[model samples]
Target: MNQYPLWKNLLILGVVLFGILFALPNVFSQDPSIEVSAARGHEVTEATPDEVRAVLQNVGVPFKAVEPLAEDKVLVRFPSSGDQLRGQEAIEAHLADRYNSALTLVADLPGWLRAIDAQPMYLGLDLRGGIQVLIDVDMEAALEQGLERYTGDIRSLLRQEKIRYLTVMNDANRVTVKFGDAETLDKGRKLIDREFRELEFETASDGKNFDLYARLAPAEEEQLRDFALQQNITTLRNRVNALGVAEPIVQRQGERRIVVQLPGAQDPARLKEILGATATLEFRLVDTEGSVQDAVEGRVPVSSRLYYDREGRPVLLKRSVIVTGDQITNATSGFDQNSGTPAVFVNLDSRGARRMREVTTENVGKPMAVVFIENRTVTEMVDGEPVKRQVRTEEVISVANIREPFGRRFQTSGLDSSEEAHNLALFLRAGALAAPIQIVEERTIGPSLGQENIDQGVKSVVYGLAAVLIFMGLYYRIFGLVADLVLLTNLVLIVAILSLLQATLTLPGIAGIVLTMGMAVDANVLIFERIREELRNGSSPQASINAGYGKALSTIVDANITTLIAAVILFSFGTGPVKGFAVTLSVGIFTSMFTAILGSRAVVNLIYGGRRLSKLAI
Candidate 1:
């Protein structure tokens, strides 16, 4: 029985410790890989897998493969190369393709992992030197978008019904449609209610005059706001993920704010260029017959101006905007056979198609333009190049008069190259942010800072372990050495389990391990002290050892139970790094209890078995 327990304890400890040591290489080893993290104005967040793929695709970089980690992160590895940037560019382009956003280049691991390489644990931004971006999604912007949508729907409905109105304007966040009679107003209100279930209306009548105000209900407003926030977070995640940044933290902070953390971002300027821009595409109708001539001749239409040279770019005349970018569902890059150059293929929804048909039919054989806006401003081409536009209809979908639903997949052909088309597709897919977001807070940690944290964390663990070992050995003597052996064994088992789980080690987690190391000796101390007490009462050595373990068992269970309860509470309430610490601590406590109680008992039994002891050391 003694041989069995001793062998069992040794076998368990050896298997766990050896398992961790063996698996370490696979988890942390750098196999010609690229990792990305973002930095914006001193804020850093790790890039998601999608973000990393985007960067790689955008830059035409090649990767062997890409693997995803939980929490919007990725692992990217490239073939060994002399040009690291080239590999990075490939990864960046992949990220952009997948996420449609730029990537912030993170750390490039050494060709191999050495003995001193960081433990396979989550390195928090505070310890890893990264970026933190706190974005406040603009509520006003989301409201404006919703309002615009409502207005567009109203106009289309009126046009379809052929109801003429004198003034149709959206002012003060309310769509004011003045019809010739109250009957028309009543009809319009009912039509709106039928289409938009989320809309709320208040009607006012003064004699024959009438006005209707349409708005969102309180519950609907809250829902809309939440949707807007989620969209913002999603978009941000997409963009950051595209950048090939590693381990980015993108999360909704409050009602209308998001927090992004990039663990390794080198270029802040590039991050700003990618994150701050709002890419929007619109199709405006052209009044080809009389636009430039009449406007220059002082015949400007109401609410429309003839810009001879608008935004200091071109001399193009347009009458009224037919459709906003919101109607566009998808855009892709393709080629026009006639010109043999690059082009973008664009797709619209049913409403957009109908509007396109009407506008194109009305202005056949005329010049039209597709306006691309970034951040509410039109993006101007540096060179004045001829850009052709096409308007598609139902005929394009169901050719030969066959009835077919329009395919969701549409192309935006006629771009210069695959890159341009890809970029456009990315932009369209990203769509308009449900709201505008402003960075309210940002913090950037440097690589040096991360290194410093590592240094301090290691120092604490070393000192803490040393102090514990010294105190245990001096107080418990021979039994203390056995306990110390168990304590070291406890660390090995904890790390093995952590590695097996692929858990990230944060600074607090290091403290947790240190605490576990200190407490590992508690059970052994209990048993050894009890044995000494028994020896003073003239008990035999074997009897003393048995008595000591039996007496200590109840105390160990009570103490460990309280510790386990606290660990569970910490884990439940904590987030990110704190949670990691709690997990490691809890795991450590359980392992320590097993090794300390069972392991120490096995060791004492081996020492005292089948032997008559002359004296028992106290």
Candidate 2:
């Protein structure tokens, strides 16, 4: 045999060594994230800078930053301990005693990055520990929203066609409207089919036998249901996002079911409250001479409303509504010229605009109230008391295109800061969850659990690798030793690449690495067996060595390609665990091919390339 060549082997070894040097630091470097939780039934409202600063300062936690997320919602970063429980307790105590706000302890995590340490990957609730909730939306409420639209449309339709209606009642399943007489009713029915294309009219057998009912099409009924469900989900997502939970999983489960998974979530009940509370808005006329002082002095009338302007100054308005929350598209904070103080700008829908114009045109000088609930201006409190529901416009009412829930930008002014206004926006948007949701499962993983998972995963990998090394050494002799060396290098390269890519390594991912160890040995087995077969054919050592790799290439490619295809499909279709497994499996195949084929090839060529096979025992 020829002398063993060192230079070629050195070149390959140098490349592996270079990869190791480049990859280790990134793999080992870690970032840390903090976790916090909220109590059940508490909703976060906007807090002023001073209010937030005071809470953090009083908590005795060394906070680096205090960010206002929304109303009562905040992100506080502490320099020490990162213990969310401690920070929460302190804030809870402060708010309970000093601010007197109804606050709850919800879960919290670190803002984004901890430069000093590696934080654990923020796992989904299914992967890590947290709460899973499935909510069933009430079909009744959805139907009601649809019914309201129908009632208004039918009333307008009748008035336009000069048809007099004696009764209009919606019975959930169908809408029944009665005309004054048979002749008028027949004309009304024909007009409804001609003008209101969405309705299907038919005569029903009843006491008067004069009812014309319209049944919605199956597709239209389904569309209405979908619209309701979507609006509910959208509102819920907005509410959760405003709370500052990163990656809160909110998706529709079925036709009317919603699935919400709050990873690392502490108080699931608070979610129920925030989601369930329907903050509806309304506009009403304010009575004149109705002031906060009038209410305090017991001189305020039930026909009037007392409201504070953006400057906290009180004003009076009539008690009737010109428009309601349904007509509002959105609201935001702005400035008013009268008192030069901050005020809320209201945006109304087209229907709201028409109503406002009609009311304003009728009552040119009367005052009106703009009330907010859960953050949205819901209804005006008339003269410090609730008034009978009615739609009446006031002269002082300001009409604008800025509608609540408007597609375009609408604003409410009079906020202390831009932060307060933003919170208001989120509150309006969250509206309410379509229905109630209860947490079915929840668990907070302490650092101990995370550390335990890490320890166990490492132990498994170490044991598996040990087994691989022993088996390879016993089976392939010298070739086995070379395989072991390449296998070790392969593991290092895989980790280095994972670290560089910042790919998350779950428990399953570690399993992939162990499986990679076994597959890496297969490459050597194929090459060694090919060499043995060649040598048996009476081929020289150099010829056998060259033929082994050449012959093994086809088999190697076929096996790896099949495995790779499976991995790709798994990665594409699988959700959480399967995806993690696919990633590791895919990475393992690449590393195994490299170390087994290229690494072992280089080492083998070094040994037999220079005709130094005197001690070889193939």
Candidate 3:
């Protein structure tokens, strides 16, 4: 009556084995290593390992292994962190122009385990040493840029329609266009009202000149702000992915700020470079009529601007942009078919493709320049004082003749090397941020401190488990041992599920596990005490055991269900560490219920189910 069926026993055994297989990966430790990747056009071939070995040999640094990785990367493992750092520096210095090296900790799991893609659970930034940054988006600047674009579009529209205007000016919040007479002003106002539904136009006149002012509607402004924030978040996420950071966090904080946490990121400076710089692309017509020498001498043309190339050669380009980086949907680096030179293939969105077609069709045989613009901050000495200055650099990366009208896809050549092409493609793929962001706060957690946290957390779990195990083994004797075994299994199951789900673990999560250990025994205690009560009422051993579990099932379910509800609520509403705690608690509740009721009962039935006993152990 108390024994489980053969199928149920097999099913329980299968689950236990499944949990063990997934939980086994955590036993393997990570190794200190240096990851070597091609900077741009370079490739890490089989010979790359030999080259790295030579470099490390020359530097007198010993390495455990030099292995080739996918995607033109290499991994150089060392026995210690000191050797890892030394080897990384030596490699970087020797191949500064060709390769980029970063120190990292890679999992040293067996090939067979990795074949199934088994991995340990990801740890949060607090548990894994890494960098944390808080970036503040410049919403005011974004609004201003949007208004400026609208002002330019309005001017172009009026000119295209042959509507004459005396002057056009854009202030912080409004664009004003002055016409010579009321008739022209009325015609312009009607045209704007018909074409631009997002703008609200106001008309004023002082008898001589008529003026029409256009301002973005309130709803439109809010939408623009929201779009800007969302776009910046997406751009940052893309950049982080390109960096190949594992388990990075790029999330919005409040309305205009973003919090980025990069766990296991080795080089914080490189991360800052990737996150801080705003790189963008613009296609503009090369102004053949304007002399670069004239513009360089400060006599720039009204309709053209001068920019330098990567080699410091100046070229004149038109002020009007044909298309911006935002229109690019995809980009990749490859070789030109005929010349075999490094080139970037770009694919634009539908709107951008149409615009490109129109522009190229009108200006066939003319040269168009692909301009690379970067906005960065640097510290410069001014009057013997170090001052932070914002610098803007614009360079023409490619200038090619428009042989035929094309859209959607095109190739840009003239890149100096494959590395340049690769870097350009990476930048284009990441896209440009909609608004500028400044890092307002920064923090770095050292690995030693992170290790300390892990040590303490592990100690807490060990101590808590030991205390509970001893208490259970002494209090109820044999049945208590059964509960302890189930409790241990419950912990293993929780970890296996976490690893399978790839949930990040934090300190509070460890606390949740400890709390779960205590609660896991509660259900067993309820059942045991119920059995004792039945035995006191003169029931037989097997009958008392059956009565105990049957009577206690409803109460255990009710108690656990209520706690599970609270855990779910916490996970839904809480953020960061709180959510981590809630997740562990919620997962623990389910596993504990399974092990306590079904697992404990299965073992008990095996031990005492069919045997006729005069008295119980309790």
Best by lDDT: 3
Q: Per-residue lDDT of 141-167 in model 2, one digit per residue for the tens?
A: 666656555765676577666678876
Q: What does the lDDT read for residue 90 in candidate 3?
A: 80
Clashing pairs in 3: 40-419, 41-418, 41-419
Tens-digit per-residue lDDT, 554-609, candidate 1: 99899988998999999898766777779889989888987888766666667766
Q: Per-prediction TM-score, please?
A: 0.58, 0.58, 0.76
- In angstroms, how far off is 309's CA in candidate 2? 9.2
Q: Against the unseen true structure, what C-alpha lDDT does each candidate score?
A: 0.61, 0.59, 0.83
Q: Alpha-carbon error at 271 in model 2, in Å?
A: 11
Q: Which one wins by lDDT: 2 or 3?
A: 3
The CA lDDT at 295 in model 3 is 96
Q: In model 2, which regions exceed 4 Å deviation?
A: 1-138, 149-184, 187-257, 262-456, 496-508, 602-611, 615-618
lDDT per residue as tens, model 3, 371-465: 98777655444554434445677788888899999999998887778866786788789976787778777665544447778899999999989
RMSD of each: 11.0, 9.9, 5.6
State, as a TM-score between 0 and 1, how close model 1 is to the true structure. 0.58
